[model samples]
Target chain A: MIRTLAGLVIVLILGAVAAAVIPEMQMREELQGVGYSYASRGMDETGSSNLVTAVIVAYRGLDTLGEVVVLFCASTAVVLMLTLYPIGVKASEPSRIVAFTAKVLPAPIMLFGVYFIAHSHLSPGGGFPGGTVIASTFLLVMLGSSSVPDRNGRLPAIESLAGLSFGLLGFWGIMTAGQFLNNAFLGTGTPGSIISGGLIPLISIAIGAKVASEFSGVFKAFRNSGGEA
Target chain B: MTETLMTAIVLTLGGMMVAAGIAVLFVRDLLSAIIITGFVSLSASVMFLLMDAPDVAITEASIGAVLATMIFLWGRGKIGDDG
Candidate 1:
């Protein structure tokens, strides 16, 4: 243990020395010329205020679809883990004070989570962040009521359905527009509005649901482990 | 005006990451260490925003905060306190 600690200290000191000795790293390149033009074109054509969303869901739609698949695989692994282990433990009733706080907090948080998910297109929060918030709310529910059943099966069902819908949407894009996850068919409406970003908002909703379910599944597994031992 | 505000956000975000790293090093508890790592991930996301890479930021935040925390909890099954 002492050796490991000494090694970590040495590594940190060496890293600090190197950083002090070397010139600062310039990580970003200037977005000039056609790159800017293309981005501007995306903003104009997609009618979306969030350039990042336009780039991800429109310009690089295929990548986003693959990311969703990755998330699905991760969630599937978690489901398989819980199934194989089958930790059938439940939360013991906590102190009344703890239970009361948990009960009161979740409803307001759930409302906020839904609000964030819906307003994603128009605001700072998006599908993933909104989804995490929603997941935490579900966690609050598990903590509060203590009445919900083992959520392992429910998680898989929700995750699979959401993944399927997202995949089908991508496949539909290929069928209709000869490209994957193409929003061109849906018609990009007016810029800077919630309803204007062609299929982006719908896609965000799907992503939110998928992420929320997966996160909740992971939380459930952790809680089960705690309950057991 | 917007540019100045953005720069300030960048600085604040960077400072927060540094603070979190320092805190993680000082803390002895493994669970707290894992939790601080989550905060580090969040600060990184904010830095990503300042650098104008919101896509990378979003992914980093989600995977870093949510996914990494889950992985740490799972791995904790194998590790013990002060062992």
Candidate 2:
């Protein structure tokens, strides 16, 4: 009874606080102008048509690096979870319907994923979305076949290479522009085109590889756990 | 013009999110509950985009759509049918 009362009191307090705070949290309408200005300047300076990509890769590259690290850490955690306990059972092959869909899905999805990442600097989608799609394609393959190739080793390899490349690129930026992760290596070109942004596309590719590997690792880990248990 | 339309869409998405949350609460099956939770994340991402937080929206959508969904699936298998 005491515990229940305590929980109720806590809930009441939380409710009161939320009621007070939520009014102030109304969506700030001023951001559209600010975001537009930042985007415009970014485009003029970086020669990238995609405002969001420029912000992500050039102005906030460090944050993007941190995001990648977070993904890598998540991948490690999932892999650990899978490896710590042995699940020796193998899953059966998918049904005919699942198999046919899985086989058909990968080609188009992978192609689209690649295109999105490559053109991230010039369009709406970016590395994370593209990478998730790529991972989903791999997941489909796993769903379709019991003999799906385990990609654990390859994942780590790609992750490490991407990490290394990102670091080297950032270092190059610091040397040239006195700012880390600057798109210094990417020469000036017209905006609103795929080839315009220098480091944006490169960064997008790196992020894509990292996200894909990390997500695939998670799916595999979960599958392994289910089979083992 | 597009902005106003976007705001209306965001409001609609927000309503759907509340409904999805309610649905998640009422759903008996754990897997279906998890799937509904994905829709909630998706709805939140749409709202974020409307608010001009595209970067945050992308992150939320990706993590919400991919990582959270996978985690929920694993949790379902572990928890079995228990409430």
Candidate 3:
């Protein structure tokens, strides 16, 4: 009886929300139509054909930096948590198929990740997706290998350096263009070209490296915590 | 006709997402639940693509479907099978 009552209440609430929201949904859709103007203008401003990349890497760059920092913190927390309970036993070797797949797949995956990051201004992909793809290659390695050595300090170092470089780039922009992340500090090459988005491609590279290292470090911490046990 | 077909596809994918969500809730095994959640993410990515948000679709497909599932499975292994 209580379950039925809860279901009925949920349905009623959903219906109410739908009734209240459906009309506004059309209005919201129309509002998004106005976003096309922003897209066109943003392309002109950033000299990137991909409006989303321009918005992310040029217009709202600080937000992206904060997101990467959040990722770094989360990875750091995972590392601290895993270190609290260290497991001495090593991981077991993967099966033949898994091992072979891991060996053959990482190269292509890395190449694709680089391509995705590099072509963010022209494609649907960017640093976040590309970084995740690259990190997955590391995950594949962790799964396939038994005695994966814990690189005591290297991953964190790379993550820190990437983050620092990203910040320094922002400072450089500030000094050069009087704004925190000004894209105009660098040349905004010809539109639809690989190096067109000025600081965007460089920022994407920094974000990709930071995110990739952070995630791989998280995976390493988890693996060392006797995840295979 | 295309609109009707598109609506049908959307409904089908939405149904699959709902089914996967319910399956995740009801599944007794942790690993199976994690895998079902991955399916939910995968369906959501398809929905994002259909909505003309390919960037979001890629992020969802890569991070949500693949990475989250792998991480969950790894965490599950650490927790052991008794749970």
Candidate 4:
């Protein structure tokens, strides 16, 4: 009772504070500094209609690569720990409804996921969200089946190759443009088209592959934990 | 009129998110808490859409509400679903 009351009091106080301060907060008038440049030149220079993708894959490519590395490390750690200490997972056959839905849904789900990754430069979704959708498809498959499907290390291989592709593309940029992950080396094609963003689309594909593989590996590890798959 | 409707919707979502966030802390069962947490994320996704960030909204809805909830439920199952 006392904890609830205390929480309520704290929330009320915070709400009051926010109400007092929010109206005074200034809204940004326009894109400025790096943001302005990215907004104006991002589409033309990178040839990606999606400004966000251009910035992520071209302007700050190294940082994005670092982020991918971070994801790799985290996924690696989870897989390693789970392998070391396997949980006893009993994979029971799901209900008829769930099994039927899972079987029917994965095809369309996979299609949407690929579309998301492929059209990321022209749309809102990029590698991360698209890759996650793909991983979720695998999750659905795992849930519907009676047993965990063994990939026999295919996921890790895909992950490594995808990660390698990202680095190789950067090195390719260095050879041509004297900069890592330069998207302009191939000549900026017409924006709003699929083949417009030079290295952006390629990098998105690599990132998408890496993310999907890593997440699938983690999910498979969880599903196959102590059970011999 | 449209602007006012959006503002009202945003305010409603924000209030529900706050309520859910608080309710999660008080909930005894772990499953209920996890579902409520997903609810909070779902509300936040709506708020992001209202703020003209469809990308953020999609990511949040998928990763936060869907993926995270599934992962949590899986973990809870592993640990024995008394939670």
lDDT per residue (tens digit) for residues A146-188 in model 2: 7645644577788788788888888888888787887846685
Q: Higher DockQ: candidate 2 or 4?
A: 4
* TM-scores for the candidates: 0.76, 0.84, 0.90, 0.91
- Candidate 4 residues B11-38, lDDT tens each? 8888888899989978888899899999
lDDT of 3 by residue, B1-83 (tens): 99999999999989888888989977898888998999889888999999999988999999998789988887776666574
Q: List where candidate 2 sits over 4 angstroms from the true fold.
A: A1-8, A25-37, A87-90, A226-229, B1-13, B49-63
Off by over 4 Å in 3: A1-15, A27-37, A87-90, A149-152, A227-229, B81-83
Indicate which candidate wins on lDDT: 4
User: How many Å off is the CA of A195 in candidate 1?
Assistant: 1.7
Question: Model 3 misses residue B39 by how many Å?
Answer: 0.5
For DockQ, the strongest prediction is 3
- After superposition on all C-alphas, the RMSD of every candidate to the true structure, in Å, is 4.5, 3.4, 2.8, 2.6
Model 1: colliding residue pairs: none
Worst 10 residues of 3 chain A by lDDT: A25-34
DockQ of every candidate: 0.34, 0.42, 0.77, 0.71
RMSD of 1: 4.5
Q: Sort candidate 1 into its docking category.
A: acceptable
lDDT of 4 by residue, A1-229 (tens): 9998999899899999999999988898998899999998888899898887888889999999999999999999989999899888776768999989989999999899888889988999888888888888888888887766555768888999999999999999999999888889998799888888888888988999999889888889888778576
